[model samples]
Target: MASSRIRTFPQRISGAMAASLGLLALLVTVRCNEQVPVIMWTSEGISLPRQAPPTAGHIVGHQQLASYLEKALDVGPRNVVLFLQDKMSIEDFTLYGGAFGNKQDGVFPNLEGALRSSSSPLVLPAVSWPASNAVIGQLQDQLDTSPLYMDPDTLSQLRLNASSPALLVFRLPYGTGSDLLSAKETLSGNDEVIGQVISIMRSQAVPYTAVYTGLQPSRKEAAALSVEGGLGGGRSLLQSRGGYKDRWRNRERQQWAKEKREVYAPVEFKEDDRTCMLLWAKGLTVGILRNNRWEEHDLTPATFGEGVSPRLHGSDCDKSKARLVLNYENVLGHRSFKLVFVMSQRHYKVSARRWFTLDAVELEYDGTKATFNGSRSIYAPAEYSYRCHSVTSFRWPLLVPRSAKDPANQWRVSFDDFQIQGFNLSGNEFSYASDCAGFFSPGIWMGLLTSLLMVLVLTYGLHMIMQLLTMDRFDDPKGPGISVPQTE
Candidate 1:
């Protein structure tokens, strides 16, 4: 009995080991399966919208539709419709109010009629994208079959083989609507046509799923549409710049003296504008620190809610220093975020021509500041311009928490379309500083010194070789100038 027990113990141990290995393999398999689909269904140029289409009842994800199709295949021969309409917005549909709370009438009458009749029609909002080759390839990969491309206008001619599951993809023609109401009518007609086709499919007892893709309209078009027949929401739509709001908005409401400024102050240039410094800055952008990096946030009218507006200060000329301040109310949890730039201006001579130099620059944001005091001495080269200078890339680092230890984790701010005038600038011509390469860097100087040393060594060696004349010390006096053989 003892011998039998010992034999079974090893057998039981082997079985346990095998079960653990199987479990490990299953975990690895699940991980691999989870990772593979993300890469497989990964697409580019597809932006999940921030706001839901007001008219599209609900939006469905690509994965959700794909999963539904996969399951529907098991039920019976499935007919899936992927209707990709071009440049259609959810606001165009009479289903919901437009982006600015405009009353949208029945733009999709036929489609609405069909939806009313159907018990459970799968109509959900999707992002607007034209059917690209990549999208087609993705669909093919998911369905394990090439989609039969058919025109939505000629859907009556679509002949799908009922024996096999069909993935029907219809790409409507691009709309040429001149105005908003026309655009609405055009989109409505498309929806009606598609809806009529869907109703026919239902009558044929074919199990079908329909998807409608819509675009977000441009500000220009929205404005034009608002003028034609839209409610006053068009102005609001044009002013909409999407961003997250922080708690600083309440603080900004109480503090009005520090934040209010003119949106646009006329730029004045004098005939002899040498004493003052004027800086013009457009397109203000703010960067917020997140995950130890600077994430860009475009400062817009809508970013700080309805009442507060972002304004640019410092259009007026200053005698001593040029100051340009971009103030944002309620930005990144701050009640007032000001990007202040102070540049000290001076007149100088360059190549017998009168030029101006910005000797020093001080940039301040939040609580930290980056000051660059340029060399103004005659010995050191400085950036001196004859006219106005424009800089597109002026980036400054902000002192963040981890930045003290790791420079790579620092946050930075950037400026664009920045111009400094009042330095004898005439007309539209700009003159940049010639001394961009101020001095040789340490590495360059080292390389130059190494090259000079090599040249000196080679020259010395050549001189020594020239001086090494072989003397005819071997005098053949006995042999009457008989020279020894050159080579023995």
Candidate 2:
């Protein structure tokens, strides 16, 4: 019986080793088959039915406008197209008088024919005179009616003809409220015209600077219309009043002088000028902490525009210096969504301190209470000495929705005063470290432990083989001893 047991030990050891190897393989297969959740980030606040945020550009006098165009053309090959409303140009109507059937009507009836026949140079007194390099091509004037009347095919052809990074200048007619009917009529027409043009530009992803020089109810009205038509915030330059013009020009000169004095000023505040994007769910309730009091601010589609903050000002803090906080909650029966906050400061600088926090905990910044789970600081060096804008972006993931069909849940939060300390690093160096224990799931740890056990098992198997190889067979007195016939 002892001899038989000794012979079977090898077989038993082999079976146990095979079983361990098979179990490890099964664990690996099970772990790999499990699904991993995916997360997405966006800069545009919660998804909405409104148009995209506007681009950045300035609205100055004709001379300053011409300078911008000239600079744009001098750099490289660019498509610069001009659209002039026949109402804004007396010369255009005079040149194409016959097309309207009666010269006194002041209407150029045949827009296509007039555009094809006109040979005069496209000129705007507010921009520049004479010619600056023949950069402006494909001038479409004698457009006496709303752009809605123009041929869609012609617009399509124009878009195709325009090169990448094109500059489209729309000098449309904006009516005043003195004549309500006329104003309504003009606005409706203008909306349709500008809307179509914007659609084309957006489809082609072209960068355009629209200059509205005609009559309008007010500067605010003009800006609202431009933003509604999808012009970028800084890119659409509405023509302001003469007083406003002088003030803007003075500011520009002062800024230029400051730039000349401190060549490194931009480097110091480089990160402040950048565009920051934050996203949150729609219909989120927000609050502002002011003077140790919390003020509620309702978030709605009507409140958001080209700027980062809503239309309503919550606190006495300066718009540039104000800090923002986002809160998210995890609960049952709610739709999961995100909010996107985009800040684009042109010729100005802005700094952002971002953080994340759980719904169960409360956060404090400078003695003000806010809710957040994590935080991060962002900084970027200036890329251009004269004028450069930094673009920094971060995202926060809300809790997974319990049900996809639940009505959107609402939450309120507030922003309070906070101090920021600056840290400068040479060249563009960045580091990220996380201490959250739950960041990794259980499967990961299990896989690691299984690998360690496999390594130990392999080492033990090797040691057993070595022992078998070097052991003395005579030392086992219980085994089937060599039949020496027991000479004693």
Candidate 3:
């Protein structure tokens, strides 16, 4: 008795549209106070180098980043707490003598007592220092908790101390180098872990010292001279550098720099400058041309092998920096891409002629690449990676200056990032500033807006599509000989 018009209704949303809106709302809500362009995939990672990296190189990155933050708060080692998430600071030749002790936690006989000493680096009085036994024990537990993304145990340990100027280096699990069966499995939960960290940070009221990501190539992490390590560390070293002449050196360092010299002028080709990030599409095999146009660069016999293609280079100062990263998102056909960076030093050793150099490069995008670059404290490029240095990638941090000579007063380090945003697999490297005003540059915000619009349009289009499919309108009127297969 009822003739239905198929319950005609204008579909306003689809599952995809609803999901997109939810994510957008979540983004807007999560970033209410911040105007900085939101990067969603930033995940948690650590860099526990097998041995100690040099102090001079590792301390400068943070120092520079800290200088930028000091505008709001009086900052330094004394007031701030340092979290050596990985072996980066511990293993490199450069040393950072903070509350966390040395590579193995034995550097300081007593962290609390050390801070209390007159010669201690503490700017704040020992009474204000959070370097107590309980705090140290808590930190040890946190550092050793899961050895990967911050698990509940690690989170509990982190929350145990209310240290004011705390510095954290969340190590990527693969630094251990034992059970990384594949790439994705090794760099686990980077984006998820980052989200968790942001949640914890937001819940707190008192703003703590700056948060950072430690970046490096675990493969280049040299072996610890001590007997403390197990099978994993020794194996990783052999797998990467076993056949090389200098087992202790970065085989690819010099070559990385050589490429940079080709692109820019010698002056522009200073150390620690990023050239570009090489990206490839995901869900792709070695030979297939991605998206019918983008070329493939999966040199590895097996797709997505652990080794990185582009080499790295920098200065002897170990103060110069650069980074090359990978990326994948279905929106971009899940193509792989790179983000190269050139970071300037914090406590730059000023000379009549200022020069900078780099140590190693890290590959991000796949979760496993987090051990080195995810920390945000490291950078490198595929320049000149040839010859005698014992190691390639290591933990490098920058220290900031207290006072300035010019309002442009701040250091002028160039930044080159290679990005791929649209349907095109193409990208290019570029230079930018990290100063206060440039921190939130117009270009980044514009990109974010464009991405947001695209997401919305795609969502709405799908909503209409789903609506049409579910209704009687999309039904095959003939309903016969409809055995045609789909085509790409």
Error of model 3, residue 169, in angstroms: 5.2
lDDT of 1 by residue, 386-476 (tens): 2212232233322122224432223344334444544443343332323233246666789999999999999999999999878766766
* Most accurate candidate by lDDT: 1
Q: Which stretches of candidate 2 lie over 4 Å from their true place?
A: 1-62, 75-77, 81-153, 157-177, 204-211, 215-488
RMSD of 3: 28.2
RMSD of each: 25.6, 32.3, 28.2
Which digits, one per residue and each the tens of the lDDT, describe model 3 over residues 1-488? 00011011111345587675444333222211111110001111211112122221112222333232333233222122223222122111112122222334222222222222212121210110111212323332433321122343355446534453343434333235444334223333333353454456435433333222222323232323221243335446544654653332343335544664544211122223432222222222211234555333332222233342333232112333333322333212334433233333233344323322322232233332222222232222212121111211211222121234321111111122211111111113221111111234576789899999999999999998888744333447778544446871
| Better-scoring candidate (TM-score), 1 or 2 | 1
* lDDT for residue 283 in candidate 3, whole number 0-100: 24
Q: Model 2, 1-488: lDDT tens per residue?
A: 01121111111234477675444333222211111110011111112122121121112233544454444344422443344332322122222232223433323222222222322112221111112112132111111111212233345666433344444444445344445456435544654565566456556654433322222112333324434453343222332333676576568657756765642111011234432222222233444445676455443333333334432122111222323333232212223222322121122233233222221213222333323321222212211111112111111222221233322112233221111112222223111111222324576789889999999999999999888765344646777656555774
Candidate 3 global TM-score: 0.19
RMSD of 2: 32.3
How high is the lDDT of residue 246 in model 1? 21
What lDDT does candidate 1 reach at residue 243? 24
